[model samples]
Target: MIRHCVFIRFRPEVGEAEKAMIFTEIAALKERLPGFLAAHVGANVSPETGMDKGYAEGFIVDFADAKARDTYLDDADHRRTGAKIVAAAEGGVQGVLVYDLEIPD
Candidate 1:
């Protein structure tokens, strides 16, 4: 399985409702795209200081494998959603971080 993690720091003016809408849109991708196993989205609630690096929200999407992950990256819907995120995020693309990990047997 491949775990695709995304962290975001929204622009200061972005409201909770807008963020929620973004999350919902992202979650909806599971039904539209193949190879999307599951997803989880939420705000960062960590108590540790200076660790979050201004990223206050994030999500994790699980895929069946790297091929599925690659497919997701290339999907037009996913690209559109990503563009929304970048537009809302502080510093544009700089406000987001993505990390993909492959689970071993």
Candidate 2:
């Protein structure tokens, strides 16, 4: 399995409603694309200080394998949603961080 994690530091002008809508759009990709095993999106509620840096929102997407993840990365919907996220982020594309992990069977 492949776990695709994304963290975002939204711009000051981006409201809570817009943030929620961004996450909702991301979650909806699971239905539009294939090989999505699971997905979770929400705000950072960690008690640990200084851990999250400036990233307040994030999402994790689980895919069956690397191929699935690759497909998702190339999907049109994913690109559109990513553009929205980047636009809302502080430094455009630089305001987002993406990490992919491979889960052993």
Candidate 3:
């Protein structure tokens, strides 16, 4: 299994409504993409202070395998959604962090 984690530092001006819209768009991808197992998204809720380093929100996508993950990377809809995230980020793409973790079955 592949765990695709995305942490975002949204611009201060971006409001909750817009953030919800972006997350909703992300959640909607399960219906369109193959092997997209699950998606978990929300704001950082850590008790520790300053640990988020401005990345106060994020999402995780679970894929059946790397092939599915790669396909998602190439999907046009994903590309469009990615663009929305970049646009809302603090420094374009710099405000986003992507980490992929491989889990044994």
Per TM-score, the best of the predicted structures is 3
Measured with C-alpha atoms, the lDDT of residue 4 in candidate 3 is: 98
16-45: candidate 3 lDDT, tens digit per residue: 999998888888889989999999999999
**lDDT of residue 29 for candidate 2:** 85
Which portions of model 2 miss their true places by more than 4 Å?
Answer: none
Candidate 3: count of backbone clashes, pairs at least 3 residues apart or interchain: 0
Clashing pairs for predicted structure model 2, backbone only: none
Ranking by TM-score: 3, 2, 1
RMSD of each: 0.9, 0.9, 0.7
- Candidate 3 is scored at a TM of 0.97
lDDT of 1 by residue, 1-105 (tens): 999999999999999998998899888989977889999999888999779999989899999999889989998888998999999999999999999999985
Residue pairs with clashing backbones, model 1: none
What lDDT does the true structure give each of the candidates? 0.92, 0.91, 0.95
Best by lDDT: 3
Give the runs in model 1 whose Cα sits over 4 Å from its true position: none
Residue 4 error for model 2, in Å? 0.3
